[model samples]
Target: MTERVVVDPITRIEGHLRIEAQMNGKQIDAAYSSGTMVRGIELIMQGRDPRDAWAYAQRICGVCTLVHGIASVRAVEDALDYEIPPNAQLIRNLMIAAQYVHDHVMHFYHLHALDWVDVVSALQADPKATAELAQSLSNWPKASAGYFADTQKRLKTFVEAGQLGIFAKAYWGHPAYKLPPEANLMAVSHYLEALEWQRDVVKLHAVFGGKNPHPMFLVGGTPNPIDLDSDSAVNASRLALVQTIIDKMRTFVDQVYVPDTLAVAGFYKDWFYRGEGLGNFLVFGDFPSAEAGTNLRDPGSWWIPPGAIVDRNLNEVQEVDMRADAEIQEFVAHSWYDYEDGNDKGLHPWKGETKFDYQGRGGPDTPYKQLNVDDGYSWLKSPRWKGKPMEVGPLARVLVLYAKGDEATRALVDDTLGKLGADKRALFSTLGRTAARTLETKLIADKMQSWMDSLMANIKAGNTRTFNETLWEPSSWPSEAKGVGFMEAPRGGLAHYIVIKDEKIDNYQAVVPSTWNAGPRDPQNQAGAYEAALADNHELHDPKQPVEILRTIHSFDPCIACAVHLTDEDGEEMLQVKVR
Candidate 1:
């Protein structure tokens, strides 16, 4: 008999997610991914002023807070044909670059590392041996035996007190864990260090946007005012502070994050061969130059180019046109939604509907043990590019750049692949997805300094403007306007579609990265990225633990909170449970 294993509310991710897999003994026969909540942000955006949409949209997720705000304003600007000042563009680049470096590092160390590094195994590690191993990886200063011993002691306290806190509820001694004790100790030490480092890194966002977790954004340009003499504005002191934060980000990524990933990866080299799902990849492209008349999606000007790669082919990159009819679409056939035409039909974002037509096992009052996968299940809608399921995130973005023959991307990717002793084809698997995030983090972190220099140069040349007031009024817009605002967010490609009529939002739909990677099966019964990857040659060392399943899903850094945003301020809370 085929056995089914369920892992509900997968820990360490941004939102609630449940993964169910059908197993033929030890190997996975098939898998299903479901988002348990429903988001009404799209419906809430309707009939609101387009200028204020960013404020509401940015609340989609507190983790990826700023990305929605940036995409929202860009959509309004795109619709109005409004152009921001060159200085404003440079500032936006700096802010976004900071977000990528900050968010990617956090995801690797805090969210995904636990799946690979066995914390209980760290207790068996010799501090001296761990220090030696850490020293060999990089010149990170906290590699002494004393540092390792202290972290081990702290972990021991948590375990002894029967309160692992953040480390609680993990499958402690799973057989699938491949890291040695010393390596686990090293990763755990860095994990704590990353927490402290991130606190300082977010200051850069506050310097530019006035705060973190939901930075302020203007439609035509950035909200920050540049005044070298004014202490209240983005003056010389704040500019220097931004540079300092950038330096710190570069140091941690080079010294800690990259080195730790390689060290752990050396022990789990087999992961390079598994979890390669939907070889098709997509990126909308971002990081526009401050130069006059530069297009954001222009391959030559963008730091990360926008394109699509089909069948793992790197010879030619197909252009991604969001505005192209039927180029991008969402399917709700297997989702908890109903389309105006039919559940089987796909709808473009501009004409997207948010009708909730849930027909699951229960009527939303009581929860079911498992989702009814045959009909409507997930709140997430399957997103496809030109009728093909595509993977998005760092791996996709890096591959697109590599295929475009960008010098920096090719060199970094080639060097990393060489160090791993893996071929270019290895970039298609779970390990590749994890490693790509580190490589892209370094790339974006390094570019931040150059952007800072450019911003300062523009200010020195007497260009201090950061906002364009000409298009700030809704009266300046046409009676009807529609546009798409897209960006390469930390998780992957994120776009917000907006339809405005008479200066208010007629309709708005946001297709985030998780929607593409974690949605349920599509209209043609095509498995989404998460489901497909989990079913791709996945084997369970112990079905009771299911660590192998997490390795693949966490590699995508699944963020279902972006997909479904329902919350109850006053209601009976359900007791959380762990399923295996």
Candidate 2:
């Protein structure tokens, strides 16, 4: 009999999430992904100065908060038609690159590694054999006897540190952890190393901005500029240091990260074949330029198995409209907000009317009204994709980039696939999604270093210009304007749409990464990114310890911290608020 199996609060990932799997026997028949927690971020932005939006948006996610800040600024700048100097552009690129690497390393080692590589399993690993394995991989950090010994010492130190933090909450001894002891030891060492690396890299953001978590990003340009002679600019010595870090990163990607991913995939080949979510992809190109009327950072568009499906071929790709997509609308039907369900509804924050009344059932009375409300769920709003659920983040970006291949990207793709014993076809599956993210990280990192070097050269050649001659007053603003600023964040495409009036933000809306991944069902009852992925995952061995769930979700690098709230009566219904 097909019955519902819910994996609420899926662990070891960002944000609060629940996956309801329709099960027949031991396997899953279909699944629904839901995240309804957190409240009032967008609504809080109303009536505030447009510049303040960056400050508030940064609070979206502690992990990748800077992306939100950057996106916010970009939207306002787009609306205002202002441009910054080349140096500022380069500075922004470097800041973003640091965050990308930091997020990637942390997610790999701290967030996702424990599932495949066990810590306790290390006790059984033969140190000698592990050393050999490392040698065979060539140039791996853990290959040396000292590194292995240091790993043991550090493990003890972390244990003594007595703060596993999220790891403490992890199911370490669970049966799903299948790595050998030696492998576990190596992975554990990498995990600790990654944390340190991430901490150091985050400082890059702090150096330019005030803090790390949510660095202040400017709209027209950087509020500050590097004085080449003022000790802040890169001298011959500092440039060397930055270059050195890039070199080391390249080495790690080539010798350690790439090799390790491939090596681990050998053991978990099952992931390559299964958990293939709706195989459609979308990418709004990233990286903006100082020049106007030029799409310098053009989107190399591509789609694999592209098309929309109603219900039968539910795994096909579909684009849910952010502005008017019925599946994309917010409903106060069961939310805490008291409003007429028909006309005076949960207006988008740009036109929001906030009147909180938290009295409702917190759950839907029937299956047909699943998003109305439910009990025990938090206050976050629900975002729907194509009236159905979909998956977002890296997997989506990779698929999108691969399909829209330029000569440069195609070369990288071919080389990466051959090394992993994968072909173009295999990339249309779960493994491809994971591998694409790793590869893209390296690609973007290399490009960012180049951009930084170019900027330094520009400054050395006597160009101190960082801002254009543009007015900042109300007269500088347009009477009525609409524009969207899109960028590929560490997660996925993040877009912000703004409508301004007399230098004030009249209506501001944003599409965050989680809204793409974890949205609920829409009016036409379309599944979102996560829901589409879950529905395709048929082999769910343990609902309580769903390793498959973790793999699929992490492949998207789902970050629900960016999601905001909706008032719900039933408590089950969650709406995704894209408030400024």
Instruction: Residues 1-580, candidate 2: write the lDDT tens digits.
Output: 3466666677767777766777677676666666645545556665666766788877767776888787787777666666667667767777777777767766777777766776756655666777777778767655876677766765656566886554565556777666677778777766776666665566666666756777777766665455655576444554555566666666766677767777677676666666666654554555554333212223322112122333323244344333453433343332344544542233443343434555442233445323232321223333333333344556565555454444556787788778777766666566667777777777776776676777778868987655544638767566776555656688876766667776566666666777666655443444556666666645766666667677777777777774465544444446754543
Candidate 1, overall lDDT? Answer: 0.87
- 1-580, model 1: which lDDT tens digit per residue? 2467889888888888889898998999899998877777898888898989999898788788888998999898888777888888898898888989989989998999998999989999999999999999899999999999999999999889998888877788887788999999999888888899999999988988999989999888888899999978999998988888999999999999999888878888899999987888999999987874225435467777789999999998999898876899999998878988898888899999998776654345433665667787787899999989999999999999889887888999998889989998889999999999999999899998898999898899998989886765677678999988889999899999999999899999999999999999998999999998998889998888898989999999988755333433222233332212
Error of 1 at 110 (Å): 0.8
Best prediction by lDDT? 1
Candidate 1: how large is its RMSD?
4.0
Candidate 2 residue-wise lDDT at 124: 56
Top of the candidates by TM-score: 1
- Model 1: what TM-score? 0.95
Residue 83 accuracy (lDDT) in model 2: 65
TM-score of each: 0.95, 0.82
